[model samples]
Structures are given as C-alpha cells and as structure tokens.
Target: MYIDASLFMGMHAAVPGTRQACASFFAEHLRDRVWMTYEEVGRCDDVVWALPRDTQDAYYPFMDVLHSTMPVKRVPYTEDAWKTAADLPGRGVLSLRERLLMATVIASDSRLVTVNPRLLNLADQGLPVAAPENSDGRHGAFPEPLAGLYRTSLALEIDHARI
Candidate 1:
C-alpha cells in the first residue's frame, strides 16, 4: 500500500484512539511492507500543526525517532514521477500532494493506502478502498441492484467530479 501523510499524522495524534487506530491499521496491513514518498514521510517532521508541543529541539528528535523506527520504503520524486504528477487522471479537485502521492503509486504499480475522501472517491471508481473500519477491504463492485450502475448517484457524482 502507498501510505499517505494522513496515516502518519494519525500515528502521532494526541487523541489516544486516533493514534491507536493508525497503529492498528499499519500493523494489519504493513506486513506487505509499505511505500511512501519522502515528502509524505517528512510532512509532519517540521510542522507544528498537530504536535502537542512544537519546538526545534522537539521537532528534530521526533523526526529522528520516526525515521529510525518506521520501516517504510521512501520513494524518491524522480523525473518521470514528476511528469506523471503534472497530469494525473483526477485533477482540479485532488490536491497537488495527493497527485504526487498517487503518481508515485502509479509509477510503482501499487495500491494507494489513503483515507483522503478525494482519493477514496477514486477508490470508488475501482482503485479499491480499505481500512480497519471496513473489515479489511471492499471491492468497488458493481452493485447487483443497480441494473446498470452507470445510472446510480455515486457513478454520476464520480463522473461530475472528474477532471
């Protein structure tokens, strides 16, 4: 799974439940050995947004421990990856960071592991979505009741949201 920045942020959340949820999610899925961009892995390193305390001293050490502990395969932002990011399938709506992340996943031919709703929308288009909440994972299957799913509200919404 291409691990997202949000999942990493969740691991360090002040809320015990959120922290545990992230941890458990990783524990269950990371045996496949996850991949993440250096940007994603480092997104929280210098930021003060979610930390309980933000200081230069605190920040450096936090980054150190996180780097040493996590077994993520940090993918480089290569030239082709950048080109792919420039024009990913879903645009206008998806953020740059999300595009870059997905680009790397596409280049690597791996499933994206994200909780971002925008990406989840992509999952609904057949990319596949999974987390602890869904009892493993669910295929973005064609509903039997749809008769022809192209007429469903979700399909219409996904079409409308397309770049």
Candidate 2:
C-alpha cells in the first residue's frame, strides 16, 4: 500500500489526539503493508528544502523516520503515459505533475485515492479511475478502517505504478 502526499501531510500535521490515533492506527494496522511513492517522498523533500537550515536540522529526524519506516517505490513517467495524459480533456488546465501522476495511475490500472474526484470524472478520455466509496458524497456512513487502508494502498500502488 502506497500513501499519497495528502495522507503523509495528514500524518505530519494531525492534532495531538489525531496524531496519536493515526500512529496507533498505522502501527497496529499498516506496518508491513504500507508503502509510499518517490513522488510523494519528493513532495516531502520539497517541504524540507523550503525550510530554513535550522528548521531542516530539527526536522531531519522526523524525515528520516518517514524515510526509513515507509518504503518508497520509484516509478518513472513513461512515454505512453505522457501521450495518454496529453489526450486527457483537462490536459491544458492540469499541471504537468498532476497529469503525469494521473497518467501513471491510469496506465497502471490501479485505484486512485484523491480528495479531488472531478479529475477522475474525466474518464471520457480513457483514464481508468476509482475513488473512495463515500467520496462522491452519496454514502452516509464512513468506510470501515480496513477498507480505507485498502483504498489507500490501492492509490499508492497506482501512484507507484506497482499494479
């Protein structure tokens, strides 16, 4: 299971109680299965780069923990993926990175777990997409914890092109 930057940020910035909850959740639930993408780790690296030297020093340990604990899979952006992305309807509006990410997911035939569902809705252009069950705002109940984990893992696999 690979995690997106949103989930990483959520883990990083969650409130005390939430952080503990997440820590407990992850420790008890995802130790062996969870994975992260090089892109997502790169996003975290971008955050580190944006910080001041002293701040970076202070946060290095945490970053190390994230690095050592979560395996990061490096997936290249292939030519076919790029070509497919170019044909997407919102290609002009989407950022290059976003397009590559979306293409990577589609080409891999993996599920995507994004807060933005609209991007996935543009399936007319041939992008294979999936989102959390309740994300459409139609489901009344929250998904089961394991189900959420599975969804997250699926997203990661997509992002990492492991599928």
Off by over 4 Å in 2: 13-29, 32-39, 116-163
Candidate 1 stretches greater than 4 Å from native: 14-18, 29-32, 48-67, 132-163
- Candidate models: Cα lDDT each: 0.56, 0.48
Looking at model 2, residue 84 earns an lDDT score of 73
Reference-based TM-score of each model? 0.62, 0.55
Q: Candidate 1: deviation at residue 151, Å?
A: 48
Clash statistics: count for each candidate = 0, 0
| Span of ten consecutive residues with least summed lDDT in model 2 | 154-163
Shift of residue 96 alpha carbon in model 2, Å: 0.8
Candidate 1 has a TM-score of 0.62
| Candidate 1, pairs of clashing residues | none
lDDT of 1 by residue, 1-163 (tens): 6777666555445554544565456544533577788887667453433334433443444434444444678887777778878766678888887787777777777777555568778776665344435345431222233213212221111111111
Write candidate 2's Cα lDDT for 1-163 as tens digits. Answer: 3345544443333243323333343444334444445676687567556656665665565545544554545567777778877766675666676667776766666644443334546554565543323323232211354334433332111121111
Highest lDDT: give the candidate number.
1
